[model samples]
Target: MAFNGKYELESQENFEQLMKALGLSDEVIKKYKDLGNIVEFVQNGNSFQTSYNYGSKVITNEFTIGQESEFVLFTGHRVKAFAKLEGENKLVITMEGMMAAMELSGDKMIETLTNGEITVKKIRKKI
Candidate 1:
């Protein structure tokens, strides 16, 4: 799959606001605000395993397409999310009041997370 790769954060938008909305503390946000995160993905047919490596912390989740599974958010909040494929290289996950879309093109993956009116966009390059 196009999403099966290790990626490093290149840039992000409205990260601080999203962190605050997710109930993260100012100290925690400050600690990660300027740091780049590494994300890795492994896929096999309809099953996927994704790992978000944030320096000292790493959150990993395994789920199948079109199924509800437990997903751990960046804030350490766990929720039941459903994963669906929009196109060949795009995956959309919906949970609670938030939606995350991950689209892969060339060597970059653009991930957008939306909670109500607040949206955070993270662009990562395959490494």
Candidate 2:
């Protein structure tokens, strides 16, 4: 989704801050530190993922930041809707009320998503 220039920059900063707060590895932070172009973020249920290209290097990863984790930290937050991938797998979880839950902090939500319980697929970031 196309966003206003200001909104896009602010969102990028917000996402980057949230990632750092979650203690994402140095490698991940490095890839997104200067994100000035449009990037794609995909979501399924409570999980989310994204991919991007840094010059000639292509990077992609997926993590499940559940709604009850860090998602709630940013109230009134809405992800820009993008195209849905075909033939993607869905995750099955046994947590009670998982669907109805919302994350209280973006950092915690990111941590939960990276718990290795969810399968992540990488796609090329459209530069």
Best candidate per TM-score, number? 1
The estimated TM-scores of all candidates read 0.92, 0.27
Tens digit of lDDT per residue, candidate 1, span 9-75? 9999998998899788999899888664788989888899999877778889999998999998766
Measured with C-alpha atoms, the lDDT of residue 64 in candidate 2 is 53
Number of clashes recorded per candidate? 0, 9
List candidate 2 segments past 4 Å from native. Answer: 1-36, 66-127
Itemize residue pairs with steric clashes in candidate 2.
64-113, 67-102, 67-103, 68-102, 68-103, 69-103, 70-105, 70-106, 70-109
lDDT string, candidate 2, 52-109, tens digits: 4344544444445333222211222323222221223323222322221112122111
